[model samples]
Target: MARDGSVLGMIEATEFLDIPTTTLADLLGREQVMDIGIRPLWGPVPRIAGPAFTVRCPPGDNLMLHAAIHRAEPGSVVVVESGDLDYALAGGNVCAVAQRRGIAGFVADGLIRDLAEVRDLRFPVYARGIIPIPGTKAAVAPLGEPVRCGGVTVAPGDIVVADEEGVVTVPAAHRTDTLTAARTKLAKEATETLDDWEAAHRSRIDEILARGGFRG
Candidate 1:
């Protein structure tokens, strides 16, 4: 599939955005869901869905990520694998440029700086945390390569759907199947009332309890 979201198509990307990461997590399981550590830098962050533009940054050097902001195509989510968290991977201006260039958002396995500026810009950033010191732009690495971020192995062109709840990566090969399943599940859920859900939930819990011979 094209990394530019052409082969995958922007229409599919828009569909992925309609489904929250939580719904994807339920379908893809924990393996596809990013860890809790990588969360939105600010609350009420708008959901972002796009193809993964993977980048690998060595410890104490964020050259690849810095380079990605300029090169990543519009609507691509820049996913980064930072070697360490001691130094920040990106800051305000870099994020600004990315947003200006029409990049969807960022998902980094390390830290970032200038949280206030990023928040003000309303740019979506999911990372470990924020720091004051920035990493050097020295080390070099390839772009669009597979990267391990937040315990999830993100590959280029994978559908990355992220919001305040969490980040979920839908494998490129299974994008269609995943989206279909997710939409089906959501449609079923939409018709279910809370009362109906509670009754089913209670019955399932009671059955499990009975099977375990729990007397409470």
Candidate 2:
């Protein structure tokens, strides 16, 4: 896992953004664990990717997130695992600070608030849902540790790619190979999209129909 001081070990956001999350998830065999339910809250661009700064907060507590926003390296995406739900863990004020500090974005397994204000600030945030009620900040949760968010276990250094579709994480161990394979698959998909359907068929239409038990 990459820590706040270990930016050199993390992949650049540009590389992750180049390949869409759908391509990565598909190449990874539709592994649902690779993706998160979190959707983009707001930004000029609906896409963001960067090394994760994993944080674990108990349900409605967001003290760790507040600390992470200030401590995490610039360009790092703050990933929080909110144990429960029903309260907003982050809001526009914190997002404004994160953006000013050069943070890439935010992803939470819980809820957040200040949707209009967050959009007005042009900051990127992804979370399970939104709520008007804010959470308690009394708890001081751990940061830079491994945690599960959106059904996937994320380490501090894992690469996160998110867009209008959703968020997908690439384990640090698989980052290089994953990106390479996803790029290859994306290229193939592009060609397949343009090639004539008839030219790419492996069998005649009659043979296909016959296999389907159709006499016509």
Candidate 3:
């Protein structure tokens, strides 16, 4: 199920980071990065950070995922853990519902369908694989509990970031602060001052070295 109202305050958590999920993994101490059998349904985006509104479900079961759509806040990324199985748990229908609910995108450890439709809608979905067959929603995986997915331990409300590099999880406490810093860092790089400096200096680091230091 998706988290709610300061439970994890996912809506608030997303305002913090600037880097892609892979970079967050680097910042998060290289916790674990898993690649599902499938590929990214969408391209990389700078709006890649979001609070982890999670959905854990039985392999091939999708009831809880559907339920999560209603609860997840807009701009939040919904993570669906399907026990690393190659079974389809979601697809275009769910994507449509999630989009209607204003979710940012999807990250599934299992499978999904309707890739073309999802792409046409310009929705983001990362998954293990795509199957023509859909799963039956017969069981529920524990929500708000930590579950291992794609090599990372995803706790409810943890900061989730995803881009072309794939998905990464950041600790909850650091979500707000760390991402804010990253945003600052990204902005400074994007500034005109930095561009002028790089153009003039060509090698900005060499000038810093010339400015000096302790003798070795």
Leading candidate by lDDT: 1
Per-model TM values vs. the true structure: 0.95, 0.85, 0.74
Model 2 Cα lDDT, one tens digit per residue, 1-216: 435435654445558778887787786655434344566766445677888889888876788888888888887889988856788888889999999998888988888899999888878888877889988888975689998888788888788888777788887778889878888877777777434656556357767888899964
| Colliding pairs, model 1 | none
Writing each residue's lDDT as its tens digit, candidate 3 over 83-102 gives: 63655777788899888887
lDDT of each: 0.90, 0.79, 0.70
**Model 3 residue 83 distance off true place after TM-score fit, in angstroms:** 3.3
RMSD of each: 1.5, 3.0, 5.2
In model 1, what lDDT does residue 165 have? 93
Q: Worst 10-residue stretch by lDDT in candidate 1?
A: 1-10
**Who wins the TM-score comparison?**
1
**Pairs with backbone N, CA or C atoms under 3 Å apart (clashes), candidate 2:** none
Ranking by lDDT: 1, 2, 3
How many clashes would you count in candidate 1? Answer: 0
Residues 33-66, model 1: lDDT tens digits: 9999999999899999988889999889999999
Name model 3 segments beyond 4 Å from true.
1-11, 36-39, 44-46, 84-86, 180-216
The TM-score, computed over Cα atoms with residue i paired to residue i, of candidate 1 is 0.95
